[model samples]
Target: MFDIVKQWKWYDWAMLLLRMVACISLILTFIELRDQFTLALWVVVLWELAAFSVPWLCLLLNHKAYWVTETVISGGISIYLTSIFPAAYLSFIVPAFLMAANSSGIAYRWTGPVTIVLIPLLIKLYAPSTNLILMMVHVALAFAFGFAFHLLMVNHRQNEIIRTQNTVLEQYLSQVERVTLLEERERLSKELHDTMGHTYTAVIMGLESLRSTAADAAAQHKLSDLLELTRTSLDEIRGYLHELDSPQEQLPLVQSLRQAAEEFGRNAGVKVGLRVLGDEYQISRQAKMTFYRCLQESLTNSVRHGHATRMDVLLQFELQQTRLEIQDNGRGTARIQEGFGLSAMKERASRLQGQVSIHSDSEEGTVVTCSLPRALKPADDVIKLMLVDNEPFVRDSLGMILESERDFEVVGRAEHGLDAVNMCEELQPHLILMDLEMPVMDGITATQSIKQRWPSIKVVILTTFEQKGKAVQAMRSGADGYLLKTMEPRELAEHIRIVIRGGTLMDPSISAKLFEGDASDFLEEKTVIAPLDTSAPESSPLRVLYDLTPREMEILQHLSKGMRYKSIAMKLYLSDGTVRNYASALYAKMGVRNREEAIEAANKAGLI
Candidate 1:
């Protein structure tokens, strides 16, 4: 597969020049033979033609047979020419030395040189006029020169390859360093948002409350000034957070960008239109933020630099990658330049294994394109779901609704809990939506059995009842989530997605039921069964407070206002399952089974 032309070096050129000189000298010797022309002379000319043609053919082909044939033919020609006119033997030197130098090993290196040297000896037997001493000197000098050139080329080629490899290695190291820095920046941003951000928010809220209660104008003025300073600091922190986290407060990427685009249009007096070309999906959190930043930067650049009156943002989703194009109908620049905005966009794309291209024309406006490669494994890409309900209509309805989703596959439908468990074993779906009440075996039992066998499979209790007791039992039996059948399709899908991502989801109504004062039986039984589960002194009334973290206390207060898990999660910038875990911990510390019991217990302990 190696091309002689491509691999040709200076040595090859030098050898070709020597070859041309030798060929010219041989042609002059042929002219000398033409002066004494005869029929035998014509046959000798033809013989020379056959001998000379094979060597050039070997050089072109570089094949083993050609090399072997050229060696034999050239050696024979060298002997014949030496017997007739010794000067013409110089023509064989080029081809003879080339064969020796081009050969692969030291064993084959002497073949052509030996052939050239022995030609004079072979000619001496036929004609004593052969000059053996001159022939040896010529052959020795040519072999030495050709072999030296070959060695030099081998060294140069190796060095070239090494230099190219070094450049690639340096680029790889730089990319690794950049990715590490990005990951570290993300870690710090999340830590700041979760811990310091929440703390600052509390301080601001407390300052507002303090200002409301200020007795004097002087104190109120001082409080107002302090509030303003804190607010500015919070804003600065949020700006940093936004730079690192991109979408900072939003969950879904496209919806957040749509809102942001609208707000930008209103503030900047630009018309912005957003369009999505395919079904929306849950991308990695980092990639989602990358897309948001790309969009935000494009819009900002359009407003500030392009003076764009109208802009269009398009996000096209495909199976392997997502493409984003942001075009602005502005007074475009003649040429695109990389400033902070474009540089940042490129960096973001690099982090996601994507590329960004900017095309600007003074006449046609500017278009910024970003392409990101996505590696979506089967588990993360789609959810295989099973539906279990006693009612045939209910099962069919849920199945159809879930199946309608592009990313959700309804694997099976079951009429009862036992049937659901049997079908689950065969299908091994990613998630199952089951009803609590069934004829043969309840949803709770089915969930318990299925979870016992295949613990990786997530089961959500989808029942009409908002009973706190059943919810607790289902959770204890390894159900990952609980939801009322009255939920909307979108909400249901979101919940399913949350579960598939290794998060838990429970209906807010169940949270409501846990906080109400109706679960006295469950509370009494928990107190009798395990009184020391609460991490507090027996005499202390507010026992739950000792077990709760500050963040947990904040979440509990939100729950006290009857906020759902999703709302609490959003308000605090936490995941739905994180809120659920905190609530579960709160429930455990209060010796309660559900939200109502926990809230009633908290109220009794004066902890709320």
Candidate 2:
């Protein structure tokens, strides 16, 4: 529909012009006849009729295409008729409607020029016996009228173009903004899934395994092991939550300020020039993250709104407060209006009892300055270093990292094999984050040796792998905690604290892996059996799954039948509540949840 209009709309305006001219010609033809011979007038009228009728017929067929030709023919007919037969003007019927239809707007801009030429012909025919001043007066007015209509049309077109351009630009920006928001959301979800979600699953699996087992040597051992894992995980979770809430870190103002500037550089399209001047004293983590976030907001505003290509960060850590300024050369309108992000930045600064000022302009770009008062802090404590990797780069990097931290003394170091063993024995600091893979003295070995010799000391196994087997081995070997190597320095610091405090740690993914396969034979493994033709695969803990009391077996059968918790509860004539307890026991004993897992376990073990 729109395509058709685009192709044919011009003819509409042309058709209107033609109709106006036809009407004018009809009037002039009649007027010319009024004063003179009816025969000449009749001839002019016939000409007008031919000119008007033919185009209108053409318009009726495809008015949009031939309207220009129609209008030109009609206008030409009107002008010629008036010029050739002046008596036609006496009728004056067409001028009234033509004037109204064309007006002085866009449609009439050309009409004025046409009128100038046509009126002259009409006046010449009618006023061949009149004064010369009257003709001059009429001619001058016609030219002036034509120019007025032309100006109106020009202004209207300019306005229309401006509006269309503005609409297109707005739509483009909106689409871009929507895409960016979706991308950011996707990134956040992936981060949560990859990091925190996996950790939680591992920890849950270890716990559930412990909870599901009967009180035997293996069950007791798994319970003790899982309890330890959960504690360390709790500490890490606390620290993560701490990061979420307070987000404060123990770092000097200068280091974190530089980090803020670098963050902007990383996220921004252009290079962000960060210059640090003066000594940066240690500040609280809350203050550091706040300053970092504030800097981030400023950079986002500069890059996203101001369109900055370069940004600058200047800092002066005085005796009291830290003064930092970030400036960008970008585009901004002349206004003091603040966007939502800027308002949030202001709120954070206010919470810190800090002051922030922002300035922006279309030409001058944007600047954000902030000054935060340092917290009344505690004195430094002893620095404890724990390296968990056998890689030289990793251990050395960690050692160098610790050594670089003021007051962080690398009291102990470990390489491959018994070097760690020797280190553990001699320089037994407050804690040791042992790695899983070492040459002769792997993290497991080092942990076992350390625990045996110095049971009072703590150890956290740091490694890249989080397999179920490895995790269970480390826990059984008396390792105090486990952490991914990808943790930030702040996270590592918190892990050390929780380890010293007798907390357990485990990522959640490990839990999902635990309930993955049959664990009946988990206590006594290493069996090689041929495949059995069954619908479901086999499960371990074969004895426990089968040795249910007859009534319990009946309940298990009901469970395997996909019965709801409540329905199963009522089926055995026992109280629904006791049946619920029986179901919980079923889940633990079977090492499964929901009907499918129970069915698989029962079918594999031949109990159902």
Off by over 4 Å in 1: 1-4, 24-28, 35-66, 107-109, 205-227, 242-285, 288-608
- For model 2, residues 348-415, the per-residue Cα lDDT tens digits are 66666665666566787766777676543323444465565677657765664344333355667677
- After superposing candidate 2 on the true structure, give the runs of residues whose Cα lies further than 4 Å from its correct spot: 1-43, 50-133, 157-161, 202-608
Give one digit per residue, the lDDT tens place, for model 1 in 66-98: 567766776666666666665656766776577
Model 2: worst 10 consecutive residues (lDDT sum): 524-533
Say which candidate scores most in lDDT: 1
Strongest candidate by TM-score: 1
Model 1 vs. true fold: TM: 0.42
Give per-residue lDDT, candidate 1, residue 145. 69
